[model samples]
Target chain A: MDSYQVGTNTPIKLKVGIETEAITMTYPFLYHSEDDDTPYSMISPFDPAQKPGWKQLDNGNKVNGKFFRVVSFLRFFNSFPDEETFNLAIQQVKDTYEASLKGGDVSPYMMAFELKSFYKDKTCVIESELLLT
Target chain B: MKKIVLLSVLWSSIVIAQSGTEPTAALQNIAPPSSPAFVLMDITPSNIIVPENIQAFSLQTISAFSGDSSNGLSNNNYAVEFQPYWYVKRERMDFFKYNNLTTQKADDSEVTPNDYTGYNIFGDVWKRFSVSMALMNGTFDVLPQAQSYVSVGARTRLLSFKTKSQINDIKSQYTAYTTFMSSPEVIAIFAKPGLSPSEINTAITNLETYKTIVTDFENTLQRKPVFALDVAAAYSHFMGDKNQDLDDAFGRFGVWASGDLAFYTPTIGTNSHVHIYGVFRYLRDGLNLNEASDLFIETKTDYGVKMELELDKLSFAYEYITRDADDNNEERSIGSIRYKINKSFTLNGGFGKNFKSDGEQVVLFGIQWGLDYEPSVVLGAGN
Candidate 1:
């Protein structure tokens, strides 16, 4: 909270503390455009997931839930011309994560995954990563 | 060009292991730090590269280290440096000719000479503090007199604060320093061609012909991350020459802040990469030329921005600058190319155009190199 000088007459000591969590997770997605003033696409956070193009991914492996879904089809759509590929990439990430947990047979597992979507011109890419512990 | 190249080859090889260090950005008397990636922006030298700003250089034997290696960290280190440079440039007016004039006349019809060639050679010895000697000489195409100067001075850091960010491994530091010089006002008068000698002397002199106390705060962020950022701020006060008339020595004060941001793209390979960088600088100057007035209320502010890109060892940079001055406003755009040979050497060339339709054009080329040696590291006596 306070800063002080360190010198021959004034000695100083420093300390740092860190807190770790049981579940370490991240969701990554972005809206990119060549013109910085405008976004490629945006969705209303208040809108319902049931809206057209908004669909949930299959959590057959029980690894995903409302709080930890790998794919939000609508959210990933329309942002890039390769919408289908983007959706597929998200689905593949979910499937791979579930398969890994099921195959590893660990209750509390450590896993990381990424979903990537690129612009039609390939000038830019929006990527997001998730880490599960 | 051939003669220059041969001389450089011979000079560089013979002085491969000079003991001194390159100049520090904190002091305007010395050349600014330049690199292929940050050439146009004129980046500041890091503290490690110019430790003279962190601590004073003193005789190591006098403060000799004990058997305990820890004691060595507090001892003085020494270094020697020698660098020579040549520059050619031209402007619409003989900026250096009427440098000492108190007032300027605005007459477009009265064309004046502007071509110039500058030569400089500097050497320094540093221990607890550092003392450097420099000789600067230059010629004007139309002016009958060529201004030149020989200067010697010493500087030391007065105070400092340093911290590190654990998450990003960013190191931030703030330093305050005072430098005193015995050189005549000639250096200031001739440093810039068109700049009035009075203005330069008033601005360059501290308590002495060249007395300056400066405070600099800087933060260097991670270079491997998505973006690398360096930011710094400085405030300087110059006291006029004591030998000159009180009014003639009217002092000046200045403040400057700058930032350099480099965005790194995903690595293409081990040795090759692409980076886009933007640099910005703002400077404020307050000057008083009247001996009767306590201080000149007249002030000027200047700002500039530079954008650069680097692909492997080749880089290009463009900069735009605007200065609000007393007589007239000045603006210019300059573009430069750099080829970095290694950490210690670089070749640079650049051209500048005045913002005016009929503004002057300038061309510049230079070679930069330096040598550094740490006694403890070189002798393997201490860490």
Candidate 2:
């Protein structure tokens, strides 16, 4: 196992790829950035990393990741077991985010995504996207 | 960016232009011959007098009818009308700022009354226009606030008689208006035990008088109509709340009466008519909130002219009102237009302005739909 320490000058890339099919993950979960030099709580979703690759466009189209920055990451048991359940969970998150967007101090740029090819014991990737209010 | 903006504007202009096609129906001579008449009803009040030909009880629906839309369609929002002889209505309607639809007036000092939710529950019975009775209990939020102040009000036609002429005009009528108001704090004190004998007696007397007025009004309807008169009374029942706001007590038992005279233009057929009226009211209010507990009395007069013109498919009304109330007097003018698309659908628009303030104006557009049930149609189907 390689133990790497991140610093303030170094940018972090949250790799969210599926090794298998039929897997769904909750996206835009609460994430706080941590570097080897900065305090763990120093980073917040309000002020995301303004790096270039943080807004990479794929396939000549703008993906959801381009508009938001990864705030925090957590791995847990799948809260949504099936496609229908995953849709329902994402809709609830969308509704909450839209409601908070009206008069919220922080930008409401939260989202969730799923991969059909991923399954079984694989950690569900939870990422919080930074919105440019 | 400039190309996009220009393109968007052009597209919008094109869309509007295309939507402005002339209506297929030809404009008929739909002007109503007379203005709309005001009728006080407990449930659904209709300015259009229902003829005796079709008096069968049917399922009735009333709605806020909107006027002509750019899309050539009418908008009707159905009102939740409860007309089960004795019922309650809770309505929340606001004044419309026509020119500046997006911006509200910056002057908070000039507040529009009747812009809050109202709850009214009343019991009424009528035998055509000959005899009618209503007893009402209602709460009104005169100011736009969280708590609603309450009032008790009643209205009755003491006597109404038709002249022997062919027009059968209403020769004379006597109406009595009574209202009693009190703050929640005063009401709380009355609710408590061990109140003074006089205080208790006053509350009981007020209730008894309310009952007497209603009963007497009903009883007098059997008599012939003579010189008509109007009696109005208002009072506040204060139950030993010395710390309450002074303005709250100003509403206490103010009583007044007036002589009312009305002249009507002959009915343009059976469905249309115009009425012109004037009223001189004398008011006396008890000002006990101050240390002096002085009685304040004054006379306020008002005059108004109303016209209701109704045709088979079109109807409209115009009103000019002037009132002298206390030191601050006000006059208002209002006009409304409604086009009945068919038997059950109508489009309406209204414009009103306060003559005292140039900037105070209101405009409204609405649509209405009515649904009635005919038992004969259903019962005769199998035959």
Candidate 3:
């Protein structure tokens, strides 16, 4: 998945195969450059009004001698009946990203994100962050 | 890869510990709505409406500080409710579709609140589903002495309807919040450099405009459905006295259904409603001790109605329930009031007459509060 590279202004599609029973929350943040030493800026698509189906992220901003990185917070309702199924779904997400990358249809950097889940407010939260350079 | 592996191991261990073992302290701290103990004690109102914003986990307790032990219980009772849907993993969920935020179009840019008419408050079955367990020690009129009992209950909303006007209010609030978020000042805060995530969050939360919009939006989200139907079932087991042979005996089993009709009264208050509720319950009670010191079962049916006036932070209600059985008939008449001090705390009081109590008056008071659990997670680390 890390072999392919994504160029500036490329459009990346984010997909999760698991069927959700409730609304999924998504928060997007953009980092200016690799060594900017500043906090990431929260981009468009505000809370409670942002459409959840906007999976295609247009990574159009580019500056010479600087690299842009995106980080998204995706929160989904925990509808799985058991942990095994949850683990399988996470694997499926990774697999889908890998498949998309290997098929040469999209750049590997497009799917350069890591998925992790942790306990929050007595609930489970799955967070994904961009791992691109 | 190592972090993922470590997380998997940690999650697996946590799951194993939680699957069937004794509940941990964190699990016990989860707040709940009215529990089986409250139902058995007839402390809960007959209305039984599901809360609009159900917490993932909640804990509710009836303490002895209320000073009105009219129900023959001197000890505190504790209950916990859990909604599994919030703790499990979910897949393929489209937020816009479930929340009525968009039309049935594939294009995201074209999605608008005008395209949607109503949002069902009880649309998601998972959000409505809840399991509650309670522990209480009390003396019942049918029993010889005080005993400890454990009760388990489950409740869910089966159907609901919402008015078009309520949806419109929500849409308008959503638009207002969107505009606020898009304002240049708000954008400048997010665009400012050197501000940490927590700093940014604090700034956003402290903004008066942001706070007002969020509070209004939340109140709009909390509007009651025009009508809703909910069903619940509960069972209790007596631990029995040490000198008695009735240990682990069945205490009570009941199944009930409740229907509510709510009218939004913006004239009285922006966050106000008038609710009429009807409830029916069937129960098999086995706590009665006969002349031979043996427990006996009685089949009973109860039907009740409640009328409530709900304001933004206060509510008053009156309920009447009549019980019918082969041997006797009794009625419960109660008036209750609740005051919400804040988001996490509430005070409740009730005054009335209880069923089959030989004209004994009933007075009950209690408090409900929730624990806020927030654990921080670092983001944007490479895998």
- Clash totals for all models, in order? 19, 37, 14
Instruction: Please give the lDDT score at residue B42 for candidate 3.
Output: 63
Could you give candidate 1's per-residue lDDT for residues B30-85 as a string of tens digits? 22232111211121121101222111111111111111112322222112222111
lDDT of 3 by residue, A4-78 (tens): 234443444443322443222334444455445543544464432234333443344332233333322233333
Give me the runs in candidate 3 sitting further than 4 Å from their true place.
A1-4, A7-65, A69-104, A110-133, B1-33, B45-49, B52-54, B64-76, B93-103, B106-110, B117-122, B242-247, B368-383
Model 3 RMSD, rounded to 1 decimal: 12.3
**Of models 1 and 3, which has the larger DockQ?**
3
lDDT of 2 at B74: 21
lDDT of each: 0.28, 0.28, 0.56
Off by over 4 Å in 1: A1-133, B1-254, B267-298, B354-360, B371-383
DockQ of 3: 0.18
**Ranking under DockQ, best-scoring first?**
3, 1, 2
Provide TM-scores for the models.
Answer: 0.30, 0.28, 0.70
**Under CAPRI classification, how is model 1 graded?**
incorrect
Specify the poorest-scoring 10-residue window by lDDT in model 2 chain B: B33-42
Q: Score the docking of each candidate (DockQ).
A: 0.01, 0.00, 0.18
Query: Candidate 2's residue-wise lDDT over B196-284, tens digit each?
Result: 43443344335654346434432332222222333333333222223332243333332222232323222443233333323332333
TM-scores of chain A, one for each prediction: 0.18, 0.24, 0.44
**B62-99: candidate 3 lDDT, tens digit per residue:** 53322234442224466676766555544333444445
- By summed lDDT, the worst window of 10 consecutive residues in model 3 chain B runs over B374-383
